[model samples]
Target: MEGRVLITGVAGFIGFHLARRLLADGWTVLGIDNLNDYYDPGLKKDRLAQLEGHPAFQFQKIDLADRSGMEALFAGPYFDVVIHLAAQAGVRYSLQAPHSYVDSNITGLLHILEGCRAQKTAHLLFASSSSVYGANSHLPYSVHDPVDHPVSLYAATKRAGELMAHSYAHLYGIPCTGLRFFTVYGPWGRPDMAYFSFTRKILAGEAIPVFNHGKMQRDFTYIDDIIEGVTRLIPKIPNAQAAWPQDPAASAAPFRIYNIGNHTPVALTDFIGTLESCLGEKAQIEWLPMQDGDVVATYADVAELQEAVAFAPDTSLQDGLQQFVDWYRRYYG
Candidate 1:
């Protein structure tokens, strides 16, 4: 192994793929997840099963909120990098379960920050979301845009994670990078995501609910592209700026935020059409009014990401959705 790394949320979709990739890249990966029943633990276990036999991978069932466990893990070995991807991850669910967001997103992130601060990790890259764009009417969301007005509690907490990370980077001089991921989807995806649920409903010959009356748009980034962006960013540590922007995204500290997204906005109807084409079945869409805490469109301005890593998510929707549909059929059939 070239270096030791810690990945939280290892059983989750992005984390699983990240762990596999890092192991393949000759990194010693220590992965941990609470494995809560947020979705289905079976899916989580199945994701873990893929990495259990890997010689460079180690697994532990530790919650990010667990202070002692996190401290002990950090004390064991100095991680060359730490990727924090665990959180309460739904915009709608926060309405019913707000406390879960606080516990996992806010409090859990505190523990991770403390661990990294103590361990003196070289680079601490954590997951943020494009939802942080909140009620901004901007067409293409940028890292330089003001994110003070978040609509959903989920968005609030993600922004809070960024703030907390920045504080740590400033106080402790840690190299921190916050990735604002857009609507990520691919094989072994989250069951709660619209694309995943839509696939299930379509497979069951039922009408899939089209929120915002099929008028919404999203920068749906593929999971492979998301992981590739992150992988390519591991070695590109941000230096403390001499003249920091007034924007919270960049400061004199080694804290930087990047929007890792497809940058192309697809209308909901067009997305459904692509999925139907891939599945060879027409989707029965029941259009409905826009849901609360949902935006009409999300387009990313990944200029900073491209400038830093020489990469941006560019996977075509047709190609990405076809891979997803193929996996969905094989996984569910």
Candidate 2:
């Protein structure tokens, strides 16, 4: 199952871990990232530094929005698999910077689709989000659920990406798999995430914003679990179904979508309490109304994922937070 794989956003949390795993598994990885300062570029650089010395690993500074650059990249090497994880990621930021979502999530994905179409890649695995299950009142979001009502521009763009990928899969016969990741958190995670920021504020004795009056819940999947689900799926390329059941998650073409999540929802208050225990410090909670583009809760129905890959995220919040806290202390110290 090891071969040349092109991983977009290799410096990001999940991408960095996936690259390290694939490289250790004897896969030649050419990872590309824009190294944008959406968060701290220093963190991205440090993540890249960990993989730079690997013999089978190569790094390139290429933005997904760059058409010619992506064209040139695909023109050079015949990638057996393309893992598209690069995107302008943030739920609230999309409110202020709507255009960035269209550029990275929409246009950026188009360039990827075109490249995959031309290269005829074996499997094209791209990152989607649980946010795509916006405006749906369903408890455990399923891939078969209708994702027509997106609460934010970010969610809309993600839904658009799924549709675009589906179109390409149907038109060009490309094997496409869309992964809807739940609240992913761990060491070397995005600073924009609430858990990461909350840790910083709690340590500084600052009031951490508790949105939705701490009533919200999230299916916080650990980074290692996310990587494991993705790794198992890389070789499970979808085959064209002979008879389509008109399901949104599957198609007659070589296309499918799966929810990669822990399937366990933890309340926001409970999550904060767990973090406080991990940090050995009480967080000064600043209760606030729910911000725009924020969902009340997110729970994933990972039955299909388990059925497909025989794996589901089962890491407890306590253990995962402990691992993250240990890493944070070592890295920040």
Q: What TM-score quantifies how close candidate 2 is to the native fold? A: 0.99
In order, candidate lDDTs are 0.93, 0.95
Q: Write the per-residue lDDT of candidate 1 for residues 1-333, one digit (tens) a residue.
A: 269999999999999999999999999999999999989999999999999999989999998878888888888978999999999999999999999999999999999999888888899999999999999998799998899999999999999999999989889999999999999999999999999999889988999999878988999999999999999888888889989767666799998999999999999999999988898888888989989999999999999999998998999999998999889888878
Model 2 residue pairs with clashes:
none
lDDT (10s digit) by residue, model 2, range 1-333: 889999999999899999999998899999999999999999999999999999999999999899999999999989999999999999999999999999999999999999999999999999999999999998889988889999999999999999999999999999999999999999999999999999999999999999889989999999999999999999999999999999887799999999999999999999999999999999999899999999999999998999999999999999999999999999999
Query: Which portions of model 1 miss their true places by more than 4 Å?
Result: none
lDDT value, residue 327 of candidate 1: 91
- Which has the greatest TM-score? 2
Off by over 4 Å in 2: none
Number of clashing pairs per prediction, in order: 0, 0
